[model samples]
Target chain A: MSLFVQTLSFNYTKRSNILNDVSLSVAKGDVLCLLGPNGTGKTTLLRCILGILKINQGEIHIGGRAIRSLSARELAREVAYVPQATSTVFPYQVLDMVIMGRNPHLGLISTPSSRDEEIAREALTKTGILHLENCLFSEISGGERQLVLIARALAQQANLLILDEPTANLDFGNQARVLMIINDLARQGYSIFMTSHFPNQAFLVCNKVAIMNEGRILACGSPDEIITDSCLSDLYSSSIKVVSARILDKPHKEVKVCVPMLV
Target chain B: MVVAIFFTSFLFGRYPVTPDKVMAILISKIISVPKSWTDTMETVVLQVRFPRIVAALMVGGALSVSGAAYQSVFKNPLVSPAILGVSAGAGFGAALGMILYLPWVAVQLLAFVFALLAVAISLFISKIIGGSSMIVLVLGGMVISAFFQALISIAKYIADPLDTLPAITFWLMGGLSKVSNNDVIFAILPITISIAVLYLLRWQVNVLTVGDEEAAALGVNINRIRLVVVLCATLMTAAAVSISGIIGWVGLLIPHMARMIIGPNFQLLLPVSLLMGSGYLLLVDNIGRSAGSVEIPLGILTSLIGAPFFIFLLSKAKKGWS
Candidate 1:
């Protein structure tokens, strides 16, 4: 397993648990999409896995090494994180923002060297945003900013990438673009673990799907096996239909979509 | 530009020493040049103006760097060096020292100690309340600042209006006229060391501006880095305010100006703020002394010049920050 969790449980206070006994794993070259409704502890689970939140009881291992045994820098080298995009107070250049990924590799008093700049440039190229290198990060569009964040994570040089709502605020075209990039990274043998509200997105790129609700995983399997009409409808507490639709001029190909039916 | 301002500042006091005499007197220290200037001229230049000019540069540079670092660490562009109640605490200490009839050196020492004490109190309260979140620390600082300001008011209420009250009031107005060679030497070590430490951690400050959780995910030990930055910035602010009294606006305005010149990359912003702050205060000091018969206090002049210029910069630029 590229990433593994065993019986993880967490809570902010003793009165209630936010994530209860969650366990999952992702293999190399796999794209796992965690699906859940709002306020279902999906993000809390991700935080526990990233070591931001201490677990109440459980074990997490990255590449067979216990997470508690690794230092923060070591963890960063093993896993890269792409947080949701937000505006910054200062306007940093895209290249400068990307170069910040080299922080873990630097010493206490040292800055990034020229070789680190080369690595940042390579990450930018991989994300296909090399042309936006000189633009101010604040001046870019939201979708472009998301891509820049992904580039920054890639610059960490970690094989496992964890993203939180990577496609949340993007338009349809930008969503497709980001999903395609995720697919490409998985094809390049990188393990991807991401959380999303869109179940259709799991069908688009993810090979594995995990449904979480009220701090527990309801099911975990391949997308076709777990993302059913009943599972989503019950998970969302609404009526949802799973339908197969054929594309124009592509009758041989069909895709599954989740549609909500109003009373 | 800083060098030119440093040398030119020596020529513009009540004692009119010619530019050539200024150069001759400055060079005479190194080589054996015959003294063509009067004893009073030499005293005015070397003993009086030299220490004051050096104090301006050191205090200005230190305050600006501290402000820039605080702004980054707090992730708020409006943050100044006085955000943590250091200035208010120092002001109260200075007031109490004056009312107690302490000597000038003792007063400055008390101010430095109290400044650090105030920050410690703020940090302690923050730890108890919210465990190290920036907003909680800021609120803690606000409470401490208000408390210190009240203490200063009490000290003023009991002070002798004829003697101690005016002295306390003047000191609070801020100036460098009384700074001697010893005061400059005393403050130089802490100011220089703190600024050097901050300069080395410039890149980490950039990461800090990305917010706490994000910075930690990027492998930064957020608590350790925040503590170091806050300690260094407070030390520099305390030392500067102790020597020059509460000179305001340099801390808040110079960083914005530096950011305007070059965008907010601390790699360049730190050095730029240091140099610009030095030159700005020197020029302001020149105007303060030569523009009138009696030297105006630096705090008043800085506010006078800084407020209008800040407004102009804000109105002219589309966005002061990103």
Candidate 2:
């Protein structure tokens, strides 16, 4: 297992628990998508896994070492986090932005060397945006910026990647592009943990899916085994349907999609 | 360029010294050159001009570097070295010392101590109110600054009009006319060490501009780095203000100019701000002393020049900052 959490519980204050005994695991090459409605402790769980928030009870282990026993640098070597795309105050170049991933590897007083730049460039190439290396990050389009952030996470050289809504603000085409990259990274044997509001996206990319609601994990399994009409409708308190439909006439390709019905 | 400005500054004082004579006087100290200049001229060059020149450079570089570091750490381009109320506290301390008839060294000491106290109070208040978020810290600073400013007003109000009042008023205007060799030597230690520490941590400061959680995710210790930057900046700012008496614009303006030229890479920006700030204050001080028979206060002139030029820069360029 690349990541394992056991009976995790957390609360901001002592009164109300935000996460209640949530436990899950991600093994190598597994793309685990956490699906939940708004304000359902999905982001809270991610924060706990990233060690940004301390869990009130339970233990988290990454790469077989206890999270509490690892220093920030050692933990960064095991896991990388990709935050949602946002503008920066300073107009850093794309290469400079990506090279910041090498910070965990460098000494306190040291800067990124030529070797680090090479690694950043290689990551950029892997994300298919190497040509934006010299452009200002603020000058790029939204989709390119998303790719740049992914490149930065790739440059961190961690085996486990945790992303918070990687396609949250992107348009449809960019969403597809980001999803394809996520699928490709999982194929290359990296363990991915991501949260999404779109259940249709889970069927496209994620091998494992977990549905969370009101601080609890309702179900956890492979997407094909866990994603059903009634489970999603109960989780979101809306009428939804899961249907398999054929899109092509000549070879008869079928896909499962989650559709919400309006009253 | 800094060296050229440094040497050129010696020619513009009240008692004029020729260029070659200035060179011979400087070189004679190093080697053995014929002394053609009079004793009074040498005294003016060595005693008056030399200490003032060194003081100007040190104070200017210290203020600018601290300003750049503060801006990066706060992630706010508008922040200055006094963002945490160090200047206001130091100003009040100096005013109180002068009204009480303290010695010059004692005045500087009070100012430095009070500056640190003010920042400590601001941090305490911020932590009590809303943790260490940047907005609350800034608000805490603003409240403390206003409180110190009121204290300064009270100190000035109680002073004798004929004696202590004028002295406090002049000191508040901010000038290096009283900077002696001892003052320069006293301030150089903290200023140099602080600037050196900030320069060494320049790369880590860059990591901070990516925002707190992001920097932490990258394995940079966010709180530790913020604390180090705040301490170094406060130390250098307090030292500079203790000696120079609240010269303002160099801290706020010079870093922006450096960013405009170098595009905000702290590795280059910190050093560039230092050099530019040194040359800038040297020129400003030259103009202050020689541009008129009676010296204009440095604090007044910096605001006079810094305000208009800042407005012009804001209108002209929109690329360096977000």
DockQ of every predicted complex:
0.66, 0.72
For each candidate, what TM-score against the reference? 0.98, 0.98
Kindly list the per-residue Cα lDDT of model 2 for residues B228-257, writing each as its tens digit. 999999998999899999898899899998
Considering only chain B, report the TM-score of each candidate against the true chain B.
0.97, 0.96
Candidate 1 Cα deviation (angstroms), residue B276: 0.9
Off by over 4 Å in 2: A249-251, B320-322
TM-score of 2: 0.98
Off by over 4 Å in 1: B319-322
Query: Which candidate leads the pack in DockQ?
Result: 2
Candidate 1 C-alpha error for residue A261, in Å:
1.4
Candidate 1, residue A100: the lDDT equals 89
| Model 1: pairs clashing at backbone N, Cα or C within 3 Å | none
